[model samples]
Target: MPNNNQVLFVKTPSASSIKGNMFLYERKNEKQSWKLADSFPVTVGRSGLAKDAHSVIPLNDNLPVKQEGDGKSPSGIFKLWKVFSYHNLQNLKMPFVQVDTNFYCVDDVNSRYYNQLILADTAIKDFNSFEHMKLSSNGYEYGVWVLYNSNPAIAGNGSCIFLHVWRDENTPTSGCTAMAKENMLKLIHWLDEKKNPVLLQVVEE
Candidate 1:
């Protein structure tokens, strides 16, 4: 049995199913099996589970692929990168960047800033389309950066994948996974930088 000390499973079958069950498993002193630390409801993208891979994603392919502006969550094991919060009210000691006007996630495949989170005024001044991180609501209140394609971004693959706060239980997101505010806070307190934690997203049929 492969042992992943820390893992989060987001399982949902239907693309219309906004509610995916997110289970948090962790290894305590007993390393034989992971214990169910926590479980909660989460919402994925409008489309569904797919891997955001390949620059020019071919249509009618075998494995589901995530493309730019697909509104489908990329389902896979993603290295939990940075945490961003709209405000600094929480005293949680984690790697966090407070969302501001300057912060943006570049999605324009044509620009060199593809799949990168950069300041609006600094990187790629020519790019017109990008996700303004601060403009969102509770979802942007606090979330983790899911490093799906952060390294030397692939042109057509998805960008700005994240785990954020959802509007409500019935609400689905654009492409990122959304959870309740309380659940998100719990995750924030639980996460530690040393572990190199990852978010594992999967779909169940």
Candidate 2:
């Protein structure tokens, strides 16, 4: 609920649709009205939308709640923490992490590093499952970390959610939001940490 000047608003067709539209909005200050900066197509989880920690309680209690390995993208407003790229980026106002083979986002709920991005060579191998930040498929070549289920990182909740490059426009992601590489690059470059950027994912009622 922090005052955010930059927001990436993603709207899915329904709670079960994998396809969606993303609109980037910005404002000069909290009092100013948001202005649309950009718009593009994007894909979401294969299964669809699910309420996560950041979600507002819906009127219908039957809506799905997000959990680990749900194949559903979290639906809510969340802070965009940082950007990660295979190569170092310049002129980006947001915090950036240049990932290598050793970078991992741990998903092992039993491990202390659950829901965290760590250096594999330096951290204890307590986690049995994780996603390499550097992928041969290049889906993660450029990405932004979506801070969902991260403040407290509850066990069994979702983890490692991100906005990243997609394999193609027709392909849906496991859980994270994905788009074309060019759009991803544009988003990364436009993001400013000082603006308090956030992501708002939802399914229109």
Candidate 3:
């Protein structure tokens, strides 16, 4: 049902594997086959994959379901939201925001801003836990927001999911997809807003 023509597909060996492969595909239209644009080695959550609200595939009931603090990545089709970077890059094809100290992603389930990105100084400070969008490490230096649990943002399903730079192939994220910095920058430059890009995470068939 998704009308997207551009897709970033991620495939893991199983629901528990931290290692995965990411492929970028694009099509001229709904009737056209998706052409492979690029591929890269990637890593997923430490705890692995889980069914999410946006999941479109038939999933086994025994599979784990995503939850807050579960250290699992959501498995499903998700719209690629805005791109966030430590520096303001030019000529990007997707909507972008420059991250600073004021930016925070609220994760407190009880707060009204739960599962939403907000400016620390402008929003109500009711949340006790959050991730600073601008981190000391380069993991978040350049990234794309993965729109999971965001449409209606269920209290504790998950939050702050993104496609970011991984520490290394051996390092798994808390609950996001990660790859090489160069690949991430390649993705950032390649994504076209008009193409309606989406992210698809799935266990390999």
* lDDT comparison, 1 vs 2, better candidate: 2
Writing each residue's lDDT as its tens digit, candidate 2 over 44-69 gives 99998888854654423555888999
Ranking by lDDT: 3, 2, 1
Tens digits of lDDT, candidate 3, 12-47: 999999999999999988998889999999999999
Candidate no. 3 TM-score: 0.97
- Candidate 1: where is the Cα deviation over 4 Å? 1-4, 28-31, 54-63, 89-93
Identify the runs in model 2 with alpha carbons over 4 angstroms from their true place. Answer: 54-60
Clashes of each: 0, 0, 0
**Number of the top lDDT candidate:** 3
lDDT for model 3, please: 0.91
Candidates in order have lDDT scores of 0.77, 0.91, 0.91
Residue 205 displacement in candidate 3 (angstroms)? 4.2
Q: Each prediction's Cα RMSD?
A: 3.7, 1.3, 1.1
